[model samples]
Target: MLAPVLRKIIQNKTVMIERYLPSKGNLFVQKGDILEPFQKLGDCMHSPNTVYFPKEFEPVKFLREKVYFQKGSLIGKIGAKKVTADENGYMSFDEVSGEYFYEDMPVKFTLLSGLWGEVSDVIPESSVLIKTVVAEVDLVACTPNFSFGELVVFPNPTEILEKFYLESFVKSTEGKIVYVGHYADLDTIKKARDLKISAIVAGSADPVGFSFAKSANIGLGVVSGFGKLETPDFVYKLFNSVAYRHVFFHGDLGVLRIPMSGVEEETVSSKKKKTPLKVIKKVTKGQKVQVLQKPHFGKIGTIDRVSVSSIFVRFDNELGPVEIDLPNFFIIE
Candidate 1:
């Protein structure tokens, strides 16, 4: 019998799916079997399929490698991190002995079912200790869905190479990306970031250029515009520029349950011409309008009722919700 459950659970692992239908309550067991429900059925054989062994889930890691920014060595020591839980059900960390925590401690909702048992009592920060544990867990819940799986596609070598430039080879040993992008000031970066320009190919970046990137949540690529630029010099400069990595770590960790509102399509009226539900309008606003890019990618919140140009946008991209300067942006089509 065909079963989607078996196929979805064991994405990579081989499995034999058996089915017996007729007013049964979802789960069924073999007549002569004595093993538990989640236990493997057999030697992966087919037939009456006395049991079912769902496929095993293999994880995919997604990371952008070959950073352009540079000079990212740690001057101080990273003390032992105290992993603990907070009231908001989040994994957090504080320095134990030293005074600083390692900047890149891998945050976000990653599946660890096969690795850890049912996560229960969480210390203040997730890196700390697990206080409680549920005896046994349903493997189904532990299995990551296609959505979460897409979050981290394993980094391919080619993917790594594309992130770096010609004159610059990137290294990420001490939890930081070092690079040398060519730019003048914060406004220059703002202009470049708006254009989605990866590198600023020019002169020495203004001293405050790094600060601008940090504030705007943008990464400065070490461009070749600066005369006689090399990897080491770039890395050192970008390193002292920003004290911490630009990774955003927020919210709960155990079973990251966000509203999985999938991809949505909408249209806006060129003028007052209404069609379906176009959540918000932007790129250009009238005297009264607000537009925003949001924590939810592709999702836009509109303030049409109160004013115009007041909208928020969210994309699945790492940039989170971008506060598009509505007056400065425009609709292409």
Candidate 2:
């Protein structure tokens, strides 16, 4: 009998997506419109923050209720204490304290589409729904976050991410999604945040560091068990193949998304066909698995027998089958 596949999470290639703006804005794309990566979708004008000046300035000279001044123009001085308009905007005087308050003019902002897709619906001045095809990879653990950027993979998947290697990419990794290697410690996690990286993917992360990343609002993903573990070859190959492409990290859902172009037919067809459900079954002989403990850690073996919580596995290097606990082995797909 065949051993059933466990945790067979479905990774959809063509996914329906909806992106909401921070606030209501002018929507540019309508239904049936196609969108490319980073295409402008909506925009709005936002007011600059208000700046409060000290009450020392002479309020009588600027008490016109609304006085517009050029950026960097001096408003007034109070005995060698010069108060300048940091930005071009109107100012109002406080009658009680005589402090000059400056409010800058509104600034225009544009929101990008961030993915390739077909516009499915338009929520006026708020959000847009689209259908897009992508490559997906399942992760073992991740914090909640959504991010899109070019994927940059590390050269080695077994090496621990050190401060030196991360410092090398400090300048170039800003606003980009970076993939550190197999293991990441607190030092590596802190450096990534300092570099202003949009997100990071790794094989395994320290539990404490993982919590810190979540608190700091930095995106992090792990594809293997906790502690120092090498990323599975299957997952590593998938990420490496899609290098430099625009990818999305659905950290809450534990999936990585890689957008693809020029395959509309396949993408649409795949969406129409429903995926088969994964069912649990009894473990049987000849089932392949990856060992998760030392002495046999990182080794692939075949099941020789199933007895209670202990499973007997036959590794190629061992003279006889060895017994392993349930939590120490995962069936290879």
Candidate 1 lDDT (Cα, whole model)? 0.25
Candidate 2, overall lDDT?
0.75
Per-residue lDDT of 1-333 in model 1, one digit per residue for the tens?
110111100011111112222121222223333332223222211112111111221112212231111124322211433222121111112234322222222223221211111222222212211111111101111112111111111111132332333213222212222222322345545554554433322223444665566555544433221222212222233233322222111111112111110111012122322223233332322222212122222221322222254333333333543454434322211
| Per-prediction TM-score to the true structure, in the order listed | 0.17, 0.68
Task: Show where candidate 1 strays beyond 4 Å.
Answer: 1-108, 111-125, 128-188, 191-204, 214-333
- Judge candidate 1 at residue 63 and give its lDDT: 20
Q: Per-model C-alpha lDDT, please?
A: 0.25, 0.75
